[model samples]
Target: MGSGSAKTYRLAFNGTAGQYFGIWATNVALTILTLGIWSAWAKVRTKRYFLGNTTLD
Candidate 1:
């Protein structure tokens, strides 16, 4: 058992994590390459995906 920051956590493994990482990496690469428009989209996707996948009390 854990408390506070030590509380146990697990990945939902909804199976899109790998794809998310791929999108993240590709977005980062494109951001660097494009001087950063991809960053805006990446941030939006990341926020949406994170909120969509998270479960909280």
Candidate 2:
């Protein structure tokens, strides 16, 4: 009895929530200091950090 259905699997990962708070705090400080350009830097930094910390299987 095989009905075609999409089966999905998820990967398990663990990351530091504390570090995210720190990242946000630092981003705010840098943006205030650099006058908005640091916003882009912060976005890229956050993206890379998330991507690097993510795992796929």
Candidate 3:
């Protein structure tokens, strides 16, 4: 690679639908049970799930 060459990276998501469904279901159930109070935690959980399953190469 040349010094001035631009670096390229590929962003990939490796999360399966089943895995996400489980998270989504739990978040939904908890959010409803807590009267929307769990939404903040659910957002964090969802973000972590996606970020954890993503890769850069």
Candidate 4:
């Protein structure tokens, strides 16, 4: 009976899987090149990338 009064929400992904893969690959390469020293920065970047692209409605 209240169906018409219900609100609808949508969630979306602003980032593509390919883009994430590229970023992941690059980070892995750089981390290895630096002998794992770049891992910390890579982790931060990876987390930021996902968080930035995630959206709620």
**TM of each candidate vs. truth:** 0.55, 0.75, 0.89, 0.75
lDDT of each: 0.76, 0.87, 0.98, 0.92
Cα lDDT tens digits for candidate 1, 1-57: 557585576655243868689878888898999898778888888777777776643
Task: Specify the poorest-scoring 10-residue window by lDDT in model 1.
Answer: 6-15
- Cα-lDDT of candidate 1: 0.76
- Mind giving the per-residue lDDT tens digits that candidate 3 earns over 10-56? 99999999999999999999999999999999999999999999999
Candidate 3 vs candidate 4, lDDT winner: 3
Candidate 3 vs. true structure, TM-score: 0.89
Error of 4 at 21 (Å): 1.0
Best by TM-score: 3
List CA RMSD, all candidates.
6.1, 2.7, 2.4, 3.4
Full-model lDDT, candidate 3: 0.98
Candidate 4 lDDT over 1-57, as tens digits, reads: 565777788887799989999999999999999999999999999999988998889
Q: Model 4, residue 31: what's the lDDT?
A: 97
lDDT of 4: 0.92
Which regions of candidate 1 fall more than 4 Å away from where they truly are?
Answer: 1-16
Candidates ranked by lDDT: 3, 4, 2, 1
